[model samples]
Target: MFDKLTRTFSDVLRQVSGKSSISEKNIQDAVEEIKIALLEADVNLRVVRRFVNHTIEEARGEKVLRSVNPGQQFIKIVHDRMVNLLGSETEGLQLKGPDTLSPILFMGLQGSGKTTTCAKLALRLKKEGRKPLLVAADLVRPAAVKQLQLLGEQTGVPVFAVEGEKKPVKVVKQALSFAKKNSFNTMIVDTSGRMHLDDDLMKEIQEINSVLKPVEGLLVADAMTGQQAVEIAKEFNERVGITGVILSKFDSDTRGGAALSLKSVTKKPIKYVGVGEKIDELEQFHPDRMASRILGMGDVVSLVEKAQETIQEEEAEELQKKLQSSTFTLQDYLEQFTRIKKMGSLQSLVEMIPGMKGNIDEDALNSKEMKKEEAIILSMTLQERHNHRIIGPSRRKRIASGSGTSVFDVNRLLKKFDKMRLMMKKMTKNKKLQAQMLSQFNGNI
Candidate 1:
């Protein structure tokens, strides 16, 4: 998601990549470049100053000048500073009620996706085997209640709401009582959001806090807002108190300034990031992996975790077997697309990969193109899906017509799939070929 920042760091690293020694002049030049990059990405001036200063001090103190790979060493120093800015480490949610029901208060501004994030968090907790009840206390917005209800329904969690309790505190208190009666071990209170920070809003939230006594108070913010997101987090923390920050719309941010600045400005750990609109799109925020990503290195660990969470164990196992055996086919292709669709948008998936972040058309992946592709595949019969060779010109026309597409569209997918399968098959047969493929995949020269 941090395409601009990632590109900036990669370019800076490139300037030092092949150097055998670093001079003071060169280091100063690089630091100046970093300052501009950070500023361009909307990083706070104070943060940028500290970052460049720390990087220079560390670069000199570590004797990067004498190192054989001075450029790499310099980049490492910058990477470390970025990690510090983005929170030194990940933080876990608090569940401290005798291993029973624990209350968590969700707070944010309107249009911050607070309600969606609440359901995503509950789904995350449920994945960890924690039974969480979604309490829809945003009674101010009519659609808010319905949105939470749909999320709960999709995630198979219970949504607790009263018919006429207008006050958020009253709704939460009653929701908690209902949860306790139903044996729910965890209650997530989704509170209402306001257009701007106000005294009345703070009072209502404080009153809700007094009644529910939430162990965790999370502020959901849109990552696209950049430094404004961080400012919002600070204001919320100062007024209502927040335990952590949840960065939503992460899939849309290219500058990534918000993620880098929020934790440092607010002095709160980022617990999770919302990658997509799906309930399962929430990813636990990890500093080290995020650092790697900012350095233009792929996050393989997070990628695997995402796959495991989204794909069924048996299905993934089968895919692995097929990969090893060179049995990849159109059927396997369709299965992979389905799995990826469940995970999130294809553009977000591309961004998570090592070097394809800025190159992928995010809108295309998340748009009707993806749906069109799926429809084209689904229009094929079982035999056609398994064996692409059987789809003759007449059948191609029929399938295209059935799927509301042109023959060219179907041909494009098949051509790409064939090339990919052939390349994978060749790589499967030779370890060195596979390594070379991986190297090329990572954008190495």
Candidate 2:
């Protein structure tokens, strides 16, 4: 989501690359641009200064001078430094005591997507083969418990909630008891939030922490808040000693400032980032891949993980068989749309591919365009979705009426789907060609 930062770094690197030999003056000019970019993105001024200084010092080191491409060498130095700033190595969630049960607490401000993230984490833990219990300790708001319950239902996880309970500490203690009784291996406490930081709120969370002895206290901060987010994280860490940070809304137009500065400022690693609103959008924070994305390089590992999580194995296998037989159909088209829907917003998905952020129209990605297309497809009959040969003028009119869309809209969808299907067939014929095109597509992103 650091589109501006990526563009700035790319331009700076290009300028450095044009030089046969690097000089202090040239490096300073590039660093100046980077500094401005970081400041404009609302990065902490002190952190920006330190980062720029480190980059300059590294550029002047022997490694850059003896390198084949001094510009690329400088880029590597900057990337490595950025990774160090964002926490060089990943730190996974810690679970204490027996493997049969452990407590993990999530705390953050209101509207930080804490409940949704709690469900996401439960789904993740479930996939990892851990039996996690969802505890709704957010009694400050009436809907909090209901929201967690709905999420639990959607994820097929049990929600431990005490109706009308006003005390968070008591709610959590009871929830932990429920977890122990049910044999749930882990307890996740989704705590309440306040409009702003306060003593009572902190005291409540602290009391819950004291009772639960949580192995991990996760601060789910919204990434779109910029440098202020880092300050909030620091406050929480100072008050309650957060085990790690979780940056929600990473798919939004968040500058990488908070992510890059938080670890350095708070001395805590960002364990995970919420890339999308979907349950599968949660991903382990990888410093190296994040640095690569900020430098206009794609993150293939994250992309592959997203693909694996979103695309059903059985469906992929069937699609591969169809590709081998050159028998792709409109049904496959609908399936592709379904898969993308499960993966969350297309724009967000593209932005995670390293350099694709700024160049995309984010509004379009978050809009109802995909849903409208799906509706049009849903209006079609089974034969129509599969064969696409039986839709005559009358049928088209009926389908449009059923979908509440115009006949022109239906025609446009059919045309687009046909084109995509044709392109898929062409790509399937040549694996190397397809790989090359996909690589280029990733690079541009």
Candidate 3:
């Protein structure tokens, strides 16, 4: 996600990395490259101009001129400005009260992933101890209600849909009654979307807003739409007063223009982002972390949160013990991969590791490789997994044939596993190394 923008920033920074001092000419050249990069990524022209101008003005300061490391100073200025452009702070949904119902109406265009995001939010809320009722108010699109209903079933949330109900307002009205009777604390209304932002769509959303008085009228914009997402957000905010944005397809947006420009254009923070298609992939947006990632700095906090959410404490403890003893088996190694898979895609997980953010090769961490590793491990016998030392060439050939791979592939995997065990042993004993690893996200190389 945002791979292009990150590469652009990293490239621009590299040109100035070893400079003794940042001259005006150096600043100009770097800013010009950044401007082109932003424009190429389809960032809003105004946002690009403001960001470049702010960065130039700040870089000319005496603090940077007299700094020991001018390159780090330049990085700080750009990181801060990017954070401001992306919304300086994180903002969550504005719910009415703890005891009252807060209806969140999702609005966007067709194919914007609004309905799926609605279910993601409902599932997140349910996990947080909120009884959420999914209201299928999107009556315009064919099977929109059924889509939301299926997602609700997958997420273990109740869906409020009236069969043959074509009126969105009426559906929401009955959903409200049902929610209140059943003691649901929140109602997520998957409102209708259009092929384009038409007057009828606006008016219908307005009616839903007026009737339900939704606590949050969120526009679910597709980040892959580039600058058009900014325009859509502006129109939505103008016509229907959307409180925030939920950027869908964020994980697939390589350019990152919409996520950067939407907050500035709409004057509304992005409350959440759809990181993947899974119901558990919607994440609360954090501006600082996002800024960090865009500048080739990793987001360790988000990474840690993802780990804690996916890995059980006891499981983590047992894994740590195994690693410390240098007794981690192939079974433990495969389990580690499984746990990491639960966190997210390998590409995304690599981006969270501090120094590894801009440095990971997509082909190297490809999901196909992950699947192959799993297959090889699964093909091994219990004895082979327990003690890899017992697997000689014949055992390796057997495992390779069983896993549909060659003998060389099995050898490569065993080599990697051996290196990993050594690294784990070192990490367990080396406090300074562990601290250095943990501090990788401080934004100073």
Candidate 4:
């Protein structure tokens, strides 16, 4: 989501990448550009200073200046330093064994998406084969408990809330007993939040934390808050200890100041990030992969992981066979759309592919166009989907009317599908051509 920062780094790299030699002045100029970019992106002033200083010190070293490929060496130094500034390594949640009860207390300010993050984490743990119970201990906010209950139902995770309980500590205690009795291995307590950090709010959270003795006290900070989120996290960590941080609304946070600055300022890792509103949109943070993304290097590992999670092995094999046989139909095309939608938005997917960042029009990949194409495909009869060649002029007009599109639109889609199928047939039959294309793709990556 660091679009501006990515562009800046990409521009600096392109300017210096092909040079046979680079001087100290060149290194300083590049680092200066990076410093301005980070500051404009709202990164912490101290963090930006440290990152710039470290990068310069490393890039100006004799080992880098005299390397066989000095320009590439300089780029590597920048990438490595950025990775280190981001955290150096991925840190996962420290949880007890599945046999033991693991209480995870969520604390944040109001409107930070803390309640939703509770449900999202529970769903993730549930998918990971943990029996998670959502405790609606947020008695302050109106409808907070009901909101958690609704989220629990959507996620298929049970919720524990005492109807008349006013004290969050009492509710949490009862929730622990209920979880133990019900064999719930993971307990996620949604604690009350305030408009701002107040004494009463801190006291309530502290009491609940003491009662729960949680294995993880995660602070759900809003990424959109930028450095303010970092300040809030630092305060939370100081007042009531937090094991890690969770940046919510990360997908919408294009500047990415909070994510880049939180770990550095708080000395706590970002265990997870809230990418979207869906229960399944939570993603574990990987510092190396994130650094790659920020530098416009792409995150192929995360892309592959998302594919593995969304696409079934059997279905993928069947699609491959159909492509090889030249039997891929409109039905298969529509199914592919559904699978990609499940994986994520098309723009997000494009950003994950190696060498594809900032290369496509964002508006062209918006959901409206995809929905229109899906409508056109769904308006077709089952036989028409299986045998698109059978749709003549009359059928085309009817399909267009049914889909609320023009006949030209239908024809254009058919033309594109035919060309794609022909390309697949050619690639399947010609191993030499396929290898050449594969080599080209690998070169770009």
- Local distance difference test, each candidate: 0.83, 0.83, 0.87, 0.89
Which model scores highest in TM-score?
4
Q: Report residue 74 deviation for candidate 4 (angstroms).
A: 1.7
Question: What ranking emerges by TM-score with the best candidate at the front?
Answer: 4, 3, 1, 2
Off by over 4 Å in 1: 312-317, 320-326, 359-375, 406-413, 436-445
Task: Please state the error at residue 82 of candidate 3 in Å.
Answer: 0.2
Model 4 vs truth, CA RMSD: 1.5
Stretches off by above 4 angstroms in model 2 are: 17-20, 96-98, 163-167, 278-280, 312-314, 354-376, 389-419, 438-445
Clashes of each: 1, 2, 0, 0
Query: Alpha-carbon error at 367 in model 2, in Å?
Result: 5.7
* lDDT tens digits by residue: candidate 1, 1-445: 7677777777777788788888998899888988888898888888888888899898887569888778777877887888898888878987955457899999998888999999999998887888899998888777899899999999999999887777788788888888888788889999888988788778888888889988899999988888888888998898889999999988885587888788778889999999877678888999878887877766767777778877878876777678777667777787777777776666556656876665555665665876777888899999898888888999999989999999999998788878888777666667898787677755421
lDDT of 2 by residue, 308-388 (tens): 977878878889778657567666766788777676667646756655666666776754777778888788888887778
Model 3 Cα lDDT, one tens digit per residue, 1-445: 6787788888888778777788888888899998998888888899899999988898988877778989878878888898899899999888766688988888999999999999999999999888899998888888888898899899999999999877889998888888888888899999888899899999998898999988888999998898989999999999989889999999895688898888888899999999998889999999998888787777888988999987889988888888999889999888888788789988787777765766766688778887888899999999899999999999999999999999998999999999989998999989999888657546443
Q: Candidate 1, after superposition: displacement of residue 433 in Å?
A: 2.3
Error of 2 at 312 (Å): 4.2
Residue range with the least summed lDDT across 10 consecutive positions in model 4: 436-445
Predicted structure 1: clash tally: 1
Q: Compute the lDDT for candidate 1.
A: 0.83
Judge candidate 4 against the unseen true structure and give its global Cα lDDT, from 0 to 1.
0.89
Best by lDDT: 4
**Candidate 1, poorest ten consecutive residues by summed lDDT:** 436-445
Give candidate 1's error at residue 387 in angstroms. 2.7
TM-score of 4: 0.97
TM-scores of all candidate predictions against the true structure: 0.90, 0.86, 0.95, 0.97
